[model samples]
Target: MDFKNEKQGAFMVVVPAGRMDAVTAPEFEQECERLIQSGELKMVADMSALEYISSAGLRSILATAKKLKGQQGEIRFCGLEGMVEEVFSISGFSSMFPVFDTRDDAIKD
Candidate 1:
């Protein structure tokens, strides 16, 4: 996966692209760790460019969410499309966190 980060006011908008399987999931987690450590706790995950995901990706997301919760931080998701969106919905992630149609919508709330 590829992570593109941008600063938008008080939040960091992260655009994750490509497949997020076992091999790339750790990279995703690592990136989130770096951002969190840098004090960018409020993050917006823009997944529109992402093509695929696996169970390992879900695990990575869970781990990140847990870590953020401990730090009183939060991660919101936006731009979900295709199979990635379906997986998140089926996996109950849609209800677990905030989901928005765009980065602006996420940051607005």
Candidate 2:
């Protein structure tokens, strides 16, 4: 998996592409940690280019969410599709976090 991060208003928009599996999950988590450590609390995960995600990926996301929440921060997800969307739904992540159909919608609020 690859990540592209950018600041959008009050949120840090993280765009992840490719597959997020066991090997890449740790990297993803680390990147989020770095952002948080840098005082970036609000985050938006734009998964439009993500092709796949495994259970490990979900775990990483959950861990990041919990960490941010502990700091009174927030994380939202957007642009999920295909198997990625199915995985989130099946894993109950779709309800756990705020999900938007577009990056604009995710950042609007």
Candidate 3:
């Protein structure tokens, strides 16, 4: 996955393209960790270009969300489509986390 990091108001946006599977999940997780360490807990993952996500990817997101929750912040997902959105919904993550139609929507939250 190729990630483009951006700062929007109180949130840090990570726009990752391509597939976020086992191989790339760790890198994405590290990015989240970096944001957290930098005291940027409000995260918005702009997954508009992400084509796929496996169990490892879901785990990484869950871990990040948990971390943010502890810091009194959040991790919102946006621009999900196709199988990626399906997987998240089927896996019950839709209720576990907040999802938006655009990065701007997430940022506004």
- Candidate 1 per-residue C-alpha lDDT over 15-40 given as tens digits, one digit per residue, 9 for 90 to 100: 88999999999999999999999999
Give the Cα RMSD of candidate 1. 0.7
Candidate 1 vs. true structure, TM-score: 0.97
Best by lDDT: 2
How well is each residue in 10-109 modelled by candidate 2, as lDDT tens digits?
9999998898999998989999999999999999999988899999999999999999999999999999999999999999999999999999999986
Any runs in candidate 1 off by more than 4 Å, and if so which? none
Backbone clash numbers for all candidates listed: 0, 0, 0
TM-score of each: 0.97, 0.97, 0.95
Ranking by TM-score: 2, 1, 3
- Please report the TM-score between candidate 2 and the true structure: 0.97
Q: Per-residue CA lDDT of candidate 3, range 68-108, in tens?
A: 89999888999989999999999999888889988888989
lDDT of 1 at 48: 92
